[model samples]
Target: MVNDKLLQNLSRNLLKILDDDEYYDITIEVGNDPYVNIFRAHKVILYYRSPYLRRILSTNKKKDDKALIHHIKLPNILPEIFQIILSGTLL
Candidate 1:
């Protein structure tokens, strides 16, 4: 059986690792125009969290190339909305 406290702690640790440029493997660029907000996260975490993201990230050639940073563009989403996504992850 999974321990609730243990699971929550693990999830918290993963969230703490978000936007950590040193260990991050994915770069999410939200919005467009003069103001674009960039977020750094882990592809593995994202893959396990969302199927649509899994499909989209899978199709991106840059990730397959094993570059230093994988890129994803979300031109339609606002930074505020994306912030909710980032904060809501694993919560």
Candidate 2:
């Protein structure tokens, strides 16, 4: 029971990090043009939690001039679906 409570607290903290904007290192562009939604996410959390994102992030190199932020475009994924995925990931 204690372990479960600790995990729940950890999940809550991670979700807070997910909602944070200032420390984000990745910019995810979801959906097609004109209707795309941008999401700011932390690379460390994504890299450690999801293998699919890990592969996508591995190939994406950070530019020297840019603010050291990694940008990824996902035209096939709907914004709502991506939001659901993000929400489900932490829980």
- Best by the lDDT measure: 2
Per-residue CA lDDT of model 2 for 1-91, tens digit only, reads 4688899998899889978999888899999978899988888887876777788887775455466787889899888877766666421
- Each candidate structure's TM-score, on Cα atoms with residue i matched to residue i, is 0.73, 0.73
Stretches of candidate 1 exceeding 4 Å from the true structure: 1-5, 61-64, 89-91
Q: Which run of 10 residues does model 1 get worst, by summed lDDT?
A: 82-91
Q: How much does candidate 1 score in TM-score? A: 0.73
**Candidate 1 local lDDT, 6-89, one digit each (tens):** 999998887687646788888899899887988888888777777777898777755347577778898898877777767663
Which pairs of residues collide in model 1? none
Candidate 1: residue 65 Cα off by (Å):
1.4
lDDT of 1 at 81: 76
Worst 10 residues of 2 by lDDT: 82-91
Clash number for every model? 0, 0
